[model samples]
Target: MEYFGPNGDMYLATKKLKRIAIVLKPQESPAEFEIHFKRPDADEIMIKTEKDAELPHNAAIFHSAKTLVESVRVNDNPKKKRLVEDYTHINDQISTNETAIQDTLAYVNLTADIDKAGTTEHLNQIKELTVSINKEKRRRDSVLAAMIAHDWVGKREELDDLLQSDIQIQTPSTSHEQLMAMYDKLKQKGDQVAVLQSKLQNQLSWVSAEDTSRDDTFQELEKLADQLKDELDVLSVLENQRQSVCVGFLRSNKGVHKMLVELL
Candidate 1:
């Protein structure tokens, strides 16, 4: 399961398009959280620089869209880039060796807590990790009691000394080679993101050769419609007159087929 810390951050983009919000539970799919950032009466002037060069018509809207896409994408900032690399490395290690290092890591984390317990950040971590340490201690006592064929409480001090020694011996050795391997993966991911961003910016920057005039096109269409309506009206009247004249000729006394042709 994924989790978020209590910290919530947000940014405003003057040069951007649409924003949306989704459930704040699983996805960071844009939602409002409580404000940690109240505007103070400080003298620091924040000038806008993400604005694009003045372009014509729809280009301005496209520029805003470009800004929006870039703004939403993280890992572009140097600090965030480093943080992402560290997160990836940590998760990979934990997932791979979770079973193998459970007891040793528990012991190590407990000792680390002892050293860092003064800080508020470390204090929270220590509280949670202490549960793992207790579990390890209970497991150790059980196994030792079985092996010794007696109550583990009898030599509690000696048993703890031995356990500590074992945990120390099995401590993690994050060698240089392992670091380089992780770095290679991070580099590959960074390169892929760069390529994708380039493609997006290029696609968004496209402009038309000439400005289209919708008003002119609509006016022309209206003119043609009126002309067609007039022609249709004239055709309707002529057909009605022809029908009346044929009916009059049909009842002729002069055997009036020829008279009809020369009719008054």
Candidate 2:
């Protein structure tokens, strides 16, 4: 169970000694904690940590520890609570990206011997993948920095809108080069429609192999790519110029136009 501290810090109820101990980890954040497990006294409460018990002066002395725990402060500290929530969101996104990177790493397909065949293309892909991951890490850090200090970005709303635009236009998963490479092959399939579709099926497996928790992998991008492939298949039957076919396909598919615009 969860409990709230007097200052809106969150605490998890845990067991330790005959008493209880709440560890203070996040100095800022939910502190972001606000957790305490302790034994009850008539007027005071005693809090403990994992290994060490507090002496007289070292203990946290709250006038009404009971009142603090019992009292509800849902609307009391909006700013701090919001900050805690945002911090959590940023961390979750970072975790999602880190997992995606690992999944992509498995698909890297590099051999121990550098001189192995097809190694150059795989190496280039790994290099590009590293650049993409680093770019995302920087973006994550910049978002956190903006949360803390917005002066560098001129206005907070502008930054917010910019990030919102990024989400709509360049979803985190869809922006990776590996997926882009797969899409490129589909877009420029030339006369080899069957070959392209078969190849894309294998590539789609790479995408489908990623954690389904990501919105774009199994749901959005895979669906979008399939739709685009169907369109391309029809165009290939018509034997239209590859360039015109790709461009025309984008213009006609209003649903995916915004997303495919970057590739064009």
Candidate 1, residues 34-80: lDDT per residue as tens digits?
23222233222122121211223334444444554464342455743
* Local distance difference test, each candidate: 0.39, 0.40
Model 1 stretches with alpha carbons more than 4 Å out: 1-60, 66-73, 101-197, 208-210, 213-264
Best by lDDT: 2
Cα lDDT for residue 114, candidate 2: 51
| Model 2: per-residue Cα lDDT over 37-99, one tens digit each | 233521333343422322221122221222222332222345534533454464556556667
Q: Which ten residues in a row have the lowest lDDT in candidate 2?
A: 57-66
lDDT (Cα) of model 2: 0.40
Model 1: pairs clashing at backbone N, Cα or C within 3 Å: none
Cα deviation of 92 in candidate 2 (Å)? 4.9
Can you give the TM-score per candidate against the true fold?
0.21, 0.22
Cα displacement (angstroms), candidate 2, residue 190, comes to: 59
**Residue 196 lDDT (model 2):** 45
